[model samples]
Target chain A: MLRDITLGQYYQTDSLLHRLDSRVKLTATLLFIISLFLVNNLWGYVMAAAFLAVCIRLSHVPFRYMVKGMRTILFLLLFALVFNLFLTPGTPVVRLWKLTVTKEGIRMAAQIAVRLVLLIIGSSLMTLTTTPNHLTDGLESLMKPLKKLRVPVHEVAMMMSIALRFIPILMEETDKIMKAQIARGADFESGNLIQRAKAMVPLLVPLFIAAFRRANDLALAMEARCYRGGEGRTKMKPLVYQRRDYMAYAVLLLYFAAVIVIGRILPI
Target chain B: MALKLEHVTYIYGADTQLPVRALDDICLEIPDGQFIGLIGHTGSGKSTLVQHLNGLIRPSQGRITWNGRDIWEAGFPKKELRSSVGLVFQYPEHQLFEADVFSDVCFGPNNLGLPREEVQKRARRALELVGIPEALYGQSPFELSGGQKRRAAIAGVLAMEPKILVLDEPTAGLDPKGRDEILGQIAGLKKETGISVVLVSHSMEDVANYVERIVVMSQGHILFDGEPRQVFRHKRELEEVGLAVPQVTDILHRLSAAGFAVDTDATTVPEARDTILKALGGKWDGPAAGRGAMGEKEKC
Candidate 1:
């Protein structure tokens, strides 16, 4: 059951988005998220939805794969929906048992829900198309300017890539530990909250120890290989923006401008 | 108790873009008190097959039966199945988590909800069974050496008193001496207890030495299942699947190929040594008497 997690998981497929520059994709994702907030009216959301649909189609990633990420934050989405639907101060449309539903509240809730869903799908698309190595390289290159300000950009990127690489390894380890415990007749299911939490001790203690041991071994191996914290490093496959990346930026700019114009001119 | 798998198949990440068929149509019967070696290269589904024996993961296709009853059927008592078919995973030492060695061993029996005294008794006996000293029982498992930690981990599963013990690459990553010591203890336990053992390993020599039956797997299919000598006789076939025969068996085969009057059926060192010595004895008499008749007859 633990295998179902696909967060930060890269889908290997050759497509336009997959071939584009990681820095371009990363910057586009950030800009898209910013524009999502700038959107206010129905036409703005319509334009955003159209752009997302086209992007998803062009990327060739299965729609369900992107939707799966939304499941993890379903509760947060529902909470925001409820808050906007019930608490927004506007004209009340329906009242029952000390609860009021306003027309404006309905509009606000729909807008918030769309915004959250689009935000999740947009980010998931970026991760799905790009491998973790490329993602880290992209992040490090984007953050290179921070080095002038004495920020440890390389170290941070190294740490991120390491963490990303270890996620699946640690997950597999957890699954093994859980099975070993199960073989010994430890019941993880069919327990109350506290009982279940208590049962996790056997699993967690060993996992933490294994994780630390792995980290220690990795550190020693790195030191043995003369790793000196990302200094004097060269990339095997350096990132460079291609013509397609500029084309993608042009499309993104057109979409962003359309959303801004719609948000300004459209009546609420 | 006998464990029977009928047409069992397992597919990892089923319904995903790229599903992997880890086990396909695997049919085998593991009767009680038999020591069977399951040998396969990496990604050969040896671990997946062992996990199915105890119902840790249900079969994606077929049924697993214990004593003529489907284990996944309603009211199969999964906890009892798990305890009865204990699996010692690879690098099991990483699973040891209790404060002390004794308590950690006790965890399995404790999970069985047995009486405290019974749990303690089983824990102590298991520790002793694995040759862990009494003085080290109170020490934290984390403080033990690598080999000791591995033994403690094995003891944890042994405390459950399984009818069929399944170990997946139990001796991996240990020094030669440590590997032999652990394998020796496991063989000894099987002999003393008369419980069926499914030892999942890739080392041909180790399996050839201890297990009576060898099951060779490749690409989720059981390629060969027979006596160690019988399986090793198909040296070319085994090698084709990226598995080698026992070193002694290989040596014997080479000797036979070199036109020596030697028995190539020996799977163990002692058997190969005796075979080679018998051939040498015959050759010594042949050369002394200046007659090749005796040696030729022996070869035939």
Candidate 2:
């Protein structure tokens, strides 16, 4: 029943997007999110949607998968829609019980819902395509400028990578523990709120204990393998910007510029 | 009631890429009141197989019928099914979280929406089944020794009044005495309840001692399913699948191969000794011979 979560989950595929240098893809995703917020009109939103559609098509990632990712934040989208639908206060089209639907408000709600869905899908696309290791590598390299300020960028990235790597391991462990407890007749489903939470105690206690044990083992293993915190460490697959990378970056920049120009003209 | 799997196939993450076919076209029947051993190497689908019986996992293809009814059929409440097929997992003591032992054991029956008195009765009976003293019921479960806690956790499952009990390597990572105690408790529980028992284990000797039926799995497929002796007869097949026959049987096979008239099919040391002695014209010796036999069994 805990299988619905897809946050930071990578989908394995042999596609162009999956093969792209992680650093380039990471930068492009961030740029896309920024450009999404740059839109001020319906036409600008249309352009952004079209751009995302083309990217999804080119990446060979199934459109249905992206839609599934959007489903996770469906509640948030609906909440935004409801909040904006009645609270914006403009030319009311209908009056309901203590609520009024307005043209401007409905339009704003639609825009916000679309924007949020696109934003989530676009950023999640990057994580879905890239492995956690490569994602962290990209993050570490991108944050290299902050090294001058002694921000421990490498350490931060390393921690993030480790956390991401441990997620699936912990999930597997939790599954095993849950089954064990279930075999012991620990009923998690079909209970009152408090009973259900109490049911989880049997699953959670062992999980926490195991997590601590794993943390200890991982630390010792890292030390035994002489992991010295990324100091002077060389990557086996160093990042290289090729001609395709440059072209991709140029195309993204041009798209952002065109969207900004169109937004200014339409300015809803 | 015999639990039947009609061509059950289970695939994990089927809606996404990297789908794992954990169980592939498995079909078998586990009859009532039999101690069944499920043996497989790591990633051999043994875990997936047991999860199906208790309805912890649903098959992607095929149905698991208990008492001739589809477990996943509409209107089949999974909670009742789970109670019927109690499962005790390896290192089960770790899942104990209640402040006291009685409350921890009561978790199962209470979830079944039983009356408070029934819950308390089942809890006390379950604690008794696992041989826990009534005095210990009020103490924190966490404060108990590891073996006692493990027994208490297992008793929690028994409290559900399951008709069939499944244990996945219940003795793993425990001291020898702890292992023996858990196994002994299971034997007692089976006798007392007349419930079918399914044991998934890595040890062949444990299976030999406990289970009447054996099912061997490898690479997500059922390799063998029969009586314990029948399944273990194909020593070569078992070896190829990364499993072993009981060591006593192996020793007997060696003795028989060396021109002794010993029975290689003997699954226990005492059985092998009796077989060997009979082959030697019933020339049975006293304490020294018994000690030697014990030593040989230990070596095996």
The top-ranked prediction according to TM-score is 1
True lDDT of residue A17, candidate 1 = 89
lDDT of 2 at B214: 86
Scanning candidate 1 chain B in windows of ten residues, the lowest lDDT window is: B290-299
TM-score of chain A of 1: 0.96
Q: State the C-alpha lDDT per candidate.
A: 0.89, 0.84
Put down candidate 2 lDDT per residue, B42-98, tens digits, no spaces. 899888888898888889999999889999989987778888888876777777777
lDDT of 1 by residue, B1-300 (tens): 899999999999786778999999999999989999999999999999999999989889999999999999988899998889989999999899999999999999999999999999999989988999999999999999999999999999999999999999999999978988999999999999899999999878788889999999999999999999889889999999899897777878898898878899987655666687687875454343433443343223
- The positional error of residue A31 in candidate 2, measured at the CA in angstroms, is 0.4
Model 1: docking quality category? high
Choose the strongest candidate by lDDT.
Answer: 1
Residue pairs with backbone atoms closer than 3 Å in model 1 (clashes)? none
How does model 1 score by TM-score? 0.95
Q: What are the candidates' interface root-mean-square deviations?
A: 0.7, 2.5
